[model samples]
Target chain A: MIGDKIQEMFLENQENFLIPAREVAHVQAENNLNHALLVLTKIGFNVIVVLDKEARVSGLISIPLIIEAITGVTEIHFDRLDSLTVGEVMRTDFAVLNDDYELEDLLHLLVDNAFICIVDNEKKFQGIVTRREILKSVNHVAHEFEHRYDVQLHQESIFQ
Target chain B: MIGDKIQEMFLENQENFLIPAREVAHVQAENNLNHALLVLTKIGFNVIVVLDKEARVSGLISIPLIIEAITGVTEIHFDRLDSLTVGEVMRTDFAVLNDDYELEDLLHLLVDNAFICIVDNEKKFQGIVTRREILKSVNHVAHEFEHRYDVQLHQESIFQ
Candidate 1:
């Protein structure tokens, strides 16, 4: 039943989101940032979504990589833009959630990761989800719930 | 008064959207696909939104661009791929509309190009708008309309 709700939620807001999978692909952390840049250049939008060994969500590869790369880092002790690894700059503080969680929880967590990476217990990169999707899904579910409740209440009042 | 509505509409959907100036700036375009690739890679995924010179919304610079670029017409004829401009492979058929269009009109045009490029009469890319934003606006507007009409109807019925 919950899984059914999940699918329903996904459909209601499918158009509302520009998912990462739709936007870009997940790259291995071991890959060099320069290599990711080269590969990502061909990918169109330059975001390197990092995936862990389990393939679950890891971190974001952002434009800052290029900004840092080209302009180099200012805060570094060295007077040089040392080539940063995906590890050096990737945002690991990103938020992630399981699909099983209530859509409400997802909506709140979505504030962190631009896109939430959906994963199984195995931690494999299952699919990404976004705030738009969650909101859309929640709206649909609320509407459906209201309609169902309305009908039920009407029948009860008539009986009463 | 109209300004209020326009601002209201934009303000309403601000929550659902990541309305940052930095979003997708790197990958946006409406010309040669090859050139788009170059620009997008340089910019990276702030989720660059593509626009035509007149500034009409063209299509989004997606991660798939890189994936597609690796093959976007290249597989069939690699030589010609380089010759292509952002316009050739650029997504031309869009579901774009002016900011003045009613939310209902937009929902009806959800044919393709999920994101609408909000443009001026000259058709320059002003901002990338999304269904997610419109829905919130429409819902708020509908509630306001309903409340006003409900009050009016209540007064008229008492007179009757």
Candidate 2:
């Protein structure tokens, strides 16, 4: 029953359930370009998600993308970086995962993504999950395994 | 004498000695935008460095930047992504490490970089060192410690 309960918990644990959406950084599509850059640099995040008027996920912005924008990679004037808006440079190519999806499904979605947005069944934006957060989960499991092995070794030594 | 030799070897073990720069993917500034994208996708690199005609490190490009460029983030038509050149979009904000720098110096350089370009004393491009490669080195050392501990424990058990 304990194993079954753990399995059930793992299967039912969704993206929003692991971490609050608000903890992740996001900005409005209409926000100024300088503001977006400030959020990204200040937050120390590689990527920032953009939201639409209805609070739906729209596009993603990254540090490298901003660098590209400033350097005229996207044909923008370097001097005008501060004057532009986030919508002017954010990319639509982003991965979004369902908030209610199981852990197994979440892993599959993260294979090619550094982080992914979580959306509800009706496609309402929830939050995001980064590979760093998933790695923390994996570390916790590994620590538990190591602890159990140590206990087993101690028990065997005492028996001997 | 042996300890001094080990310390000398460790200190002199620079970035280029550990990982060759040619192993990393790079492009020239004059390369076609589409060709750069193809190299990035095919090589499966998160970032690609741009080299100048004299083989000096120039700029850096990333997949997200390419995406930003294609999405008209800088106001270009998505269809024209291939018509452009890499020089138009690459950013000059990158860290470069000296090939002769010590391992300790490499650690400091990597604190703010995912990877750093390596160059010899003449400033000629040598190669690169990624966070992944450094992590691998750490893992190898940890593994050696673990193996040694296991061997010591086995010896102790036999003695008992």
Candidate 3:
């Protein structure tokens, strides 16, 4: 019964779980690795969205990708950071969700990914759903049920 | 009633959720940033543990920290990767859990962290509890509940 309730709650609040695209940090595909690294450092995020000229979701870029790009068989080529663009090394094989995606789809994807990009039918970026948001929502729901049922599910405070 | 059962299940299976330290990637404090980068690139982990000479958990290292160490006010110091040691740049302000840690503690911490290092009283590394593991466990429980109750809580397959 509680499982069904949680499923319903997740489905009903699907829209609220999304971190809108406007609030997410992103870089243009043409930007060099150096610029991408700067964006990652500035925003304190492990990965950032890469957008093409038309504002479509191009790929995802992260520090590991940059490191891999610069690393040679014998040594790291620091100069490549300036020469290589995000488009050249960004990861294209990432998961994306449509507007009609289910909460179960998100839960399954978030198990392997830190976040999932939400795109429209035209592959235009809409927003992101992060593991943190989902965890927070779960914690919130647990607390809500605790209050309604007058029971203790956990002793810890709500996740911030 | 179901909330209580779920809590009991989580607590009873706490140890199963941990990813033992031996499976985790790590670097020594004496290692240079270049070596750290190599380990990260090789292991496909965003962050790696840093150990002191005594094999105690010293800190955590990641690409952002490396980038920050190499970044100057006006330029990026590419040469610092060779010059700086992991000890000079690794982040010390990370969460660590002991063997007696509760499931609630892990769930609360995993909301903000990708993984929480498990350490002994002597600060020796024991294992790690990852967000992935928690998600998998939660999914497993949902499926178990679905099967027992003979209800269709979700339409999707179990998360891998």
In terms of TM-score, the best-performing candidate is 3
Residue-level lDDT for B11 in candidate 1? 54
**Winner of 2 and 3 under TM-score:** 3
Candidate 3, residue A10: how far the Cα is off, in Å: 3.6
Ordered from best to worst DockQ, the candidate numbers read 3, 1, 2
Order of quality (TM-score): 3, 1, 2
What are the per-residue Cα lDDT tens digits for candidate 1 across B1-160?
1222323433566555434333536344435554554455455433356654544466655435433544433232334435655545555555666656554444445323345556567665556565455545434433332222211123334466
Give the residue spans of candidate 2 off by over 4 A.
Answer: A1-17, A73-76, A146-160, B1-21, B24-160
lDDT of each: 0.49, 0.60, 0.78
| Span of 10 residues, lowest total lDDT, candidate 1 chain A | A72-81
lDDT of 3 by residue, A50-147 (tens): 98877788899998888889988978888888999999999998889997887777788888988999999988898998888887766655444333
Candidate 3 per-residue lDDT, tens place, B1-160, comes to: 2255456644555667788878888899999998998999877788999987777899999988888889898578888899999999999999898888866677788888988999898888988888887777666554444333333223232221
Q: For model 1, how big is the CA root-mean-square deviation?
A: 10.4
> How close to the true structure is residue B96 of candidate 1, measured as C-alpha lDDT?
60
DockQ of candidate 1, scored on C-alphas against the true complex (2 decimals)? 0.07
Native contacts retained by model 2, as a fraction?
A: 0.00
